[model samples]
Target: MIRKLKSGQYRIYSRKVDPKTNKRKNLGTFDTLEAAKRHEQEIQYFKHKG
Candidate 1:
């Protein structure tokens, strides 16, 4: 999932919530939404690469 921060930045998070923290894992933070979306696609590609 992608979320827009108050700082005008974008953050990528895991699809599932972490049981330990009870929150989505922070995947990465990007300066632009486009960059965040691209990174999210890369993550999905790698996740199902095999």
Candidate 2:
């Protein structure tokens, strides 16, 4: 999932909530939504690559 921050930046988060913290893990923060989305896809690809 992608969220817009108060700083006008975009953040990528895990789709599932963490059981330990009860919050989505912060995958990464990006200056632009497009970059965040691209990174999200890369993450997904790597996750399923194996």
Candidate 3:
């Protein structure tokens, strides 16, 4: 999902409402929406790298 950070930029994170955890948690923050997309892509890349 796309989210706005305290820095006034947007970030992307794993979709919430999937596992539906009762508790709230923050995963990351980014300088821009593009940056967030890149981060998510990088994480995905590393996960499948091996």
**How close is every model to the real structure, measured as TM-score?**
0.97, 0.96, 0.54
lDDT by residue for model 2 (1-50), tens = 99999999999999999999999999999999999999999999999997
Indicate the TM-score of model 3. 0.54
- For this target, which candidate reaches the highest TM-score against the unseen true structure? 1
- Model 2 lowest lDDT segment of ten: 32-41
Q: Between the candidate structures 1 and 2, which one is better when assessed by TM-score?
A: 1
Q: List per-prediction Cα lDDT, in the order shown.
A: 0.98, 0.97, 0.71
Q: Which stretches of candidate 3 lie over 4 Å from their true place?
A: 5-7, 15-25
lDDT of 1 by residue, 1-50 (tens): 99999999999999999999999999999999999999999999999999
lDDT (10s digit) by residue, model 3, range 1-50? 66887879876656544466753445577787888887878877896898
Candidate 2 global TM-score? 0.96
Ranking the candidates on lDDT from highest down gives: 1, 2, 3
Note the clash tally of each candidate. Answer: 0, 0, 0
Q: Candidate 1 versus the native: TM-score? A: 0.97
Candidate with the greatest lDDT versus the true structure: 1
- Our model 2 lands, by Cα RMSD against the true structure, at 0.5
Model 1 lDDT, full chain set? 0.98
